[model samples]
Target: MYSIVDIETTGNGIKGNRITEISIFKTNGYEVIDEFTSLVNPECEIPYFITGLTGIDNDMVRNAPKLDEIAHKILEITADTIFVAHSVNFDYNVIKNEFQQIGLDFVRKKLCTVRLSRKLIPGYNSYSLGKLCSAIGIPLKDRHRARGDAHATMLLFHKLLRTPNADKVFKSFLNAKSQEATLPPSLPKAEFEKLPTTPGVYYFKDSKGKIIYVGKAINIKKRVLSHFYDKSTKEVTLCSETSYLDYEETGSELIALLQESAEIKRHYPKFNRAQKRQVQQYAIFSYEDRNGILHLAFNKLKMAPNPLHIFYSITECRLFLESLCETFELCPKYCHLQENVESCSHYKIKQCIGICSDLSYTKEYNERVVTAIESLEETKTDYVIKTKGRTIDEEAFVLTRRNIYVGYGFVSKETSLTHLDDFENYLIRQQSTLEAQRILESFIRKKEPKILKFTAETTR
Candidate 1:
């Protein structure tokens, strides 16, 4: 038994949405055994746009029965039946939420005519109720009304029941383990199933093969599945338009982060918002205190005079400063990590060396501060960072020329790479980006990287 259901809502989304009108057709496979249709007073003013699309105005449902008044009838009619609808999740979730608000539980085994039609009927330009019905010659009347759409969905479901191999398809979709009911109607199961559970960057593409969003994950399959389950409006819309998926596995998470940023910039995917915003620039600078202690600190680029090193985010600035503090054996308090404190008791930096307590020589500390600042302004030498590759037999290396990121490449472990010039043959060159720099610096700050130096003569 299946109850074909549809509802016109006062709002577009599941949460806080109230049903303005509802229609249900109780069917035993081939024929309708019972039916129910009613206008519902949602107890809220319907938005102008919703009224425009649905044609159900405040006047129409003003005197109609409230949902709580007819809740018992709904429960009785849908009892012992599987719920069916076009783009079923919307209708099913809206109704389920309505029931919950009235202190009732509505749970039913669900089926989507759109998903089923795509699987059983095969090639069609669209699976939306109106388009699919018109394409198949199903007479659809009173376009957006609950009864009209629900009736059409029932007829479509009847055709799907008779299509070849539909029994098997229906069985698979009904299985408790199936994600068929959760995925967007336009996306194919195969596209999602092929995703690898490895570290990588994934792309969500529309039907026309344009990249719409890019993301990196330690487990690509798990992360992509999370998007499907998200109920946020933006996430739901992005998933609805995603008809395909593409990915590239980078064994190292650091490499994945770099590649993900590069792809986002190159494609400028519409759904990628975080990387599109302008990055804030920070600079490390030095100053002398009342006690003649040379302190290293960071500020916004415009505020810092004679800046030592620039970074994209405050995190990068702090990380670079912390590294200098630990290396120079300088006081964290003097470095401005802990402001206005009498002495340094930093949790991360315990290498104060008594400078905060005035035991160390001011001249010696000033000299080390000079050395740290000079290191920051020194010219970047050509180098290579080697890490794990996509496959076991290969290794990956990121190249830089004079401290500017060149690109990354993979090489066979059997091939000996002695210098930065040796990686040129395998180099897949890329443009330097602020995001890439931040990611690289963060990785270097935490990990002891395999840094290989190259001289000019080696390349010649």
Candidate 2:
């Protein structure tokens, strides 16, 4: 059973808006069993522009009964039926909000004709109620009015039921539980339920399909639900604007992090504040002094030419340099930790080998610095990091050449990734950035994936 519904609102269906008119048709996929239509007195003035579009002005509904008067009829007609509409969210949410104001919980399983048409009909240029009805030879009268649109949607639903294999699809939709208990009011419960509990990046989109936030998680479903569970003002605002969710599964958490960082840089989503800025703000560089001794130093990124490692913050750069100094007995003064001192505090404490005082030969001290620099640098060779794919039988890999990220892709177990041509054919090349380099290097240091080295001979 389905209740085909339509609503005409005074403004965008947010908090301030009100439904001025509504229509509902009770159907069992073939014919209407009952019907209800009403003009709602919103208790607020309708804007002139909305009146022009919907043909419902304040004067027309001034004496009409308010939503509370007809709320019972609306519920009775839609009872035990899946809510159906052209854009189900708009119609469903408008009515739901009205019922909430009257101290009633309006929850119903929903089916969107727009989604169904996209799947069942296919090849339509537009799915708007008017355009779709016209293309499919359904005569639509009194366009923009609630009853007219609801009737048209009902006809479209009937036609969709006739599509081959649509009964099985409809049965699946009917059996699925409503996700309203856990999801935000604006997002579709069906869409939220479809999210995978896999490692990947997810995007939250507004009603217009514009991405508002990008996030990565080991479990995409759990991480996304966390946002809704949060009570912070920003999280509430994000949920309010979000109407849809989209995701990409990365088999490895390292790839997921890299992709999330790249997407945040590229999209600069309104909700993602930290990662929107350039990540490579600081870097560590090695230089030769007048005495021909190698010294490691940290500086702002633009000042460094070909840095050995990149970092997002000066503090992280300093911390890494301090660790390297402790590990290799390098002079703190050379690493910019102690400025304008003949000998650093490390030497006084016997932690340094007196490189700052020239007590250690420049040749010997420089050798340790060279080793530290090499340790921080990524392998300057072409290779791939192989990992699990989206499925068990498939394999995923990230390709890099000369310490630059090429891209990532997947292949079945039967296929061999042995040559340059294989990589070119399978890989989806991404722009190599400093952030990508840092993510790849950090992951390699921690996880150490099985690296497949490539060369010219292998390509042939």
Candidate 3:
């Protein structure tokens, strides 16, 4: 049995958003047995953009039943059905969160048509409901509406069922348990059971309480259990040697990533290969030549007096150096890629502006080097990354000063940090790793967190 479901919500599929409409079609693989659809009064003002896309505005749901009023019907209809949706996680999580608010546990085995289609159908440019339906010549009406999309998903699911290997794929998916039935041999089931289904960092420890691996996940419980399901040699060994598990809830995924990198470096976890290495082995450095041109070069990290950028491996360092050479028209010989040659290959091919042959003036070549240096120096700014805390009234922050990750700490919302000294007071300083710095830098580039100039700040 399957419950094909769709929902229209008031905001992006995150916490605090409320559902404005829902539709569920109960099916037995070949035919629809029952159905339920409703306009739900979310009891909040729907955003204008959401109204534009979904066409379910505040006025449409003003007199409709609220979610709690119809929650019981939802529960009864969905009972004993495998929850099915185009993107299962978004709909499933929204419905699950709504149920939790009403003191109910809505756990269901879930199947995503998107995943199934990609596996069973294959070769489609997109798996989105409208696109996939159009490609297969399935008529999709009322595009964003719950009942419309749910009905379309039902048809799509029927098509997937008729594929050649559908039975084999469906059986495999069903046999895969939603939750782990067994834990690592040495681990206590109680400890694993207590793992939170929240964004955070988790540590796999040995019998001696030594951390063997550190990982971060949006859902800690699921990710930890996946480790046990792995059949790889390293994972098999990790599962057998693991005796205990510990975790910290980092309310944001960015923070979780940063924390995981820092923890891996601090513990030098035996199972973590990438982050266990010393901070950085190679770097890009700047030097002035006899012509007074600032030359960009790559060398062993230990030999660089003041490197502009740090890289974990020589290969990564060389790849970045090659990019800089292309970007700034620098000679390959100047970057140490070729030795005992009067002119670089790039110079002969007209790619280099003749920095090696002195055809390019020092001032012009130096300007390009400065541009490349500035581009790679992404962490030169001093700022704090503020994000949600474990609790509602508290907030978390990761501080960086002049390219160094100072530390991360939590503070009360009612209190404000008035100065750098106050911000430092709450910090639990740890040695910064190259991975941590890179994670923080990448997150800032992508998310663009709001910046506040803080001359005087206070936190409680």
Candidate 4:
């Protein structure tokens, strides 16, 4: 049995948002068994944008039951039945968060009709409820609201059940169940319904609830679907043995990367590729003299907190620092690249800035050194680094602050530190690893990103 559900919420997020309306249809095979529907008092204003989409407003739901008032009825109707929904995660998470607020833990197996439809009926251009139904002859009476969409999805699911390959499709659906042998099991339809489309990390666990694999993706829903996109030998084997999937949403790709790194270290899932336990080895140091003249050198090191640029290995660290030194015209002797010579080897070749032997104003060369240092100090302040967004084909940005790796978030332009406090509150402190630092440095070297100054600075 399945309790196919859909909900319209005040916002997309689960933490602070509220549901405005909901619909549930309990089904057995192709027939409806029971139904429940409500317009909820979300306890907040619904944005004008959302109001236009769902035709639900604060005034309309002001007198309606708070989620707490009707949550028990929902549980009773949905009890012992699998949950089903379109683009399931939004619906599932919104409901779960609401139940959680009421001191109740609402857990259930879920199945996504979108996934089932993709496997059973391929070649549709869009999997969205309206588009899929339109392309496949399933009429949609309502586009964005709950009851209209839920009823339409139920009909589409019913049609899938009537196909010749229905048994195989159902079998795949069953296998999607997180806990196949658990007691009082709800249908597997709910879990699939709640998976989000945002970039984040996901965990896959086996029957005994041991995490087997952890992964990050630009699009969590698409990535999870891709694993089941085709039943290759590898996926087929993994699918039959898999029992549960869980995920944490990271607002930006940089945050995703940081969280993925931390999680991989913490869980050490069986299928994960082991990361190096040792700290990075590349060292950036200089050979200097009593006259305050400096020369740069690169080497692999077993020590900490010594500097020119630190990397994981001698080769990468050397190549990177060498390129910078060459670009900035620093002398070899000042960088500690050579010994006992009054003039750098580069001086003979005209590659050096001649600061070693030339009695040019000390102030000018020192200015260049300062500029170079400033150029290398990428994490010293707040800035946005642009790249391909979550969709890979679109553009996005990763935000940072004060030589610290703050969490990444998205905005169309280099958003100002108009609200640094917001950024500070949300920033996830990540390890300043050589790889991540280099990635930021490379971008800054080329674009010299516009720094957005904020009066206030805080750490996340």
Candidate 5:
């Protein structure tokens, strides 16, 4: 049994957007058994571009019955059928979200004709409903509307059913065909059904409720779906052992990062990267020896609280310190990491400030160390970093105030961060991470933004 479904929505995102139209065709192995279709009053205006593409406008749906009005009929038609769609996730989510808004739960096993066709009929340049149907000699009428798409998917499903190895493919989907491998008995089907495709973090737990894995994703639903599609041994094992699922919605990726860090540390999830043990092993340190000369060094001897920077590995810490030594003209001899030479190795190359050979003043060398320290400090004044939004016209920003790393937020292209308070509120707070740092550094390095103002620190 198959329930082929298609939907037109107010928008692509699920943040409260409503569905405007829905169509479902329930079929037995070879014939249609039931059907339902409707133009739903989404209670919102369909954007002009969408109307142009789908030929569905707000005016047309103004007097149509709302989704709640037809929810029961749809439920009845699709009951006990395997949900099918060109891209089943989208259709399923739109319907599920609509039902949820009306206090109804819609859950069903799903199949994607697009993915099925790719596996069954290889070498298609496009898998879109219209493109695939045209390529495969299937008649697709009324193109973008829900009923049209659903009908096309029904044809596609029928083809898939007749394809060679179809039985094996369908069995593979049931998670039952290959072997008698048992899945986590405690896992509820509802867990996978409700995971939204928005940015967030997810946790996997065993039968005893201990978190075995924790991960962050830009889209929770897609990431989780990936685990299911994966044929790898790790994914198979993880799926089998995943008895519980939990998630947190972070409105932004920065928040997700901070939360992931805190949670990983707090729970110490078993499957997280093994380098957790090396977090504190490497650090940048500033020290003044008995002679009252300041020195910057990469320290790996012991865990110390005076680290100017932290890294996951000693090699990375040493490389960065070495680069800084050249860039800031710091003497290597006083750094205590180099062995034996009186003048230090860099003096031969004239890269050092010569403090090691007593040619450069201690005060001058110490000033450069202070300059580097101040450069690394998060104490700079107000600044802004803008990035692309999920949509074309929208834009997002990471706002920094007096350089304490305040927060980030989004705005329209016409909006500016001129008002300090409003901009601050938009700023989302994020914990410092190599990821965020690298993102910012790469963005700044590329010279892409409008460049309101940005200044790299200099060794004073």
Candidate 6:
């Protein structure tokens, strides 16, 4: 038994969406055994655009029974029947959520006519209820209304039941292990099956092949599957529009992280919310205090005079200062890591050499500060971080010159990455972004990958 369902919603997203109208045609594959259709008062004002689409206005449902009132009837008819809809997830999820709001549990096996048609009936330009029905010479009346669409879907389902090999297809879809019902209606199963279970970045693209989201994972296929299983509003909406899957294996999480960051910044994909904002730049610089002691401090890049080092975030700036304080045996108070303290006993930096406690050590501390500043200049040396490539025979590298991320590249293991010049031929040159800087800096600090360092002259 299958209950063909269709719903006209208030157009809000999945969780918040309210059903204004619902229709169900209970069938035993070939003929309808029962039916239920109603205009439901969502208990909220219907948007004008929704009224424009389905012609179900506030006045129409004002005296009609609310969802809570009709809830029992819907449950009774749908009991012991498979849930069927054009795009089953939408209708099924909306109804399920509505039931939950009324303190009822709605759980039913779902079958999407959209995906089923693509499986049983192939080569249609579109699988939408209207388009597919028209293509197959099925009569569809009162389009967009719940009953009309549901009834047409039932008629179409009857035809689909008789298609060749449908029994095998239906059996597999009914198996809980199969993810056919979980995927977006428009996305082909083969598109998802081809994804590699390797460390890489994957793209979620719409039917037109426009990238909507970008993500990196250690297991590309597993991570992509997770999106389909996620019930979050953003995930649901993203998966709904996703019809194509694309990816590139990097074989290293570090490279994947950098690539994911760069792609997010470059494409500015709509579904990739993070890494879209501009990264704020902060700078560390030295200034002479009233006591004639040189002090190190950080400020926004534009506000700093004679900037010594730049960082992407305030946290990074403070971390760099703390490292400098510990290395140079300088007082955290002098570095502005701690404020308004008579002496330098920063909890993390116990190695302070009494610069803040005694004025006599000013000269020595000032000299060490100069050395620290010089170290910043030398830190700009060109380097290549070696990592695993997509294939075992190749190696991946992230290149940096003058302390700026240049790009990533893949080269055959036979190539001599002994010098920075070897990277030029295979390098995929990319613009530097703050997100990329954060990714590389984080990986270097945590993983400590093999880094080949050289000066400008050495590149020759």
Off by over 4 Å in 4: 176-460
- In order, candidate lDDTs are 0.87, 0.82, 0.81, 0.68, 0.71, 0.90
Which residue pairs in candidate 1 have backbone atoms (N, alpha carbon, C) closer than 3 angstroms, thus clashing? Answer: none
- Candidate 2, residues 287-347, lDDT tens digits: the string is 8878787778888888998878767688888888899888888888887788888878854
Model 4 lDDT per residue over 312-368, tens place: 766677567656667777765665556689877743334676787775645566666
298-366: candidate 6 lDDT, tens digit per residue = 999889998888788899899998999889887889899888889877888998778787889889889
Best by lDDT: 6
Candidate 2 wrong stretches, greater than 4 Å: 10-17, 27-34, 43-64, 80-82, 161-169, 176-197, 202-215, 220-249, 267-274, 279-300, 306-460
Instruction: Estimate, for each residue in 1-460, the C-alpha lDDT of model 3 and write its tens digit.
Output: 9999999999744467699999999999999999999999988999999999999998999999998999999999999999998867567777888888878899988877876787687777566799999999999999999999999999999989899999987876666663322345456556788899988999999878999999999999999989876645577568767778999998888789988888887788999987777755787898987868776777787898798877778899988888788877777877776778987885333477777778556678778878888787653656677888877988888887656788888889998776666778888686667777788778879999855433323222
lDDT of 1: 0.87
- Model 5 off-target regions past 4 Å? 176-460
Query: What are the models' TM-scores?
Result: 0.76, 0.54, 0.45, 0.45, 0.45, 0.79
The TM-score between candidate 6 and the true structure equals 0.79
Predicted candidate 5 versus true structure: per-residue lDDT over 295-408, tens digit per residue: 777765365457776665777887777777767767777665586888787533346767887844888888888887777665455567665554566666676544434555
As a whole number from 0 to 100, the lDDT of residue 357 in candidate 4 is: 76
Q: Residue 87, candidate 3: how far off, in angstroms?
A: 39
Q: With candidate 3 superimposed using the best TM-score fit, by how many Å does residue 194's alpha carbon deviate from the native?
A: 6.6
Error of 6 at 1 (Å): 0.8
Q: Which has the greatest TM-score?
A: 6
Give a tens-digit lDDT track for model 1, residues 419-439: 557789999988666888778
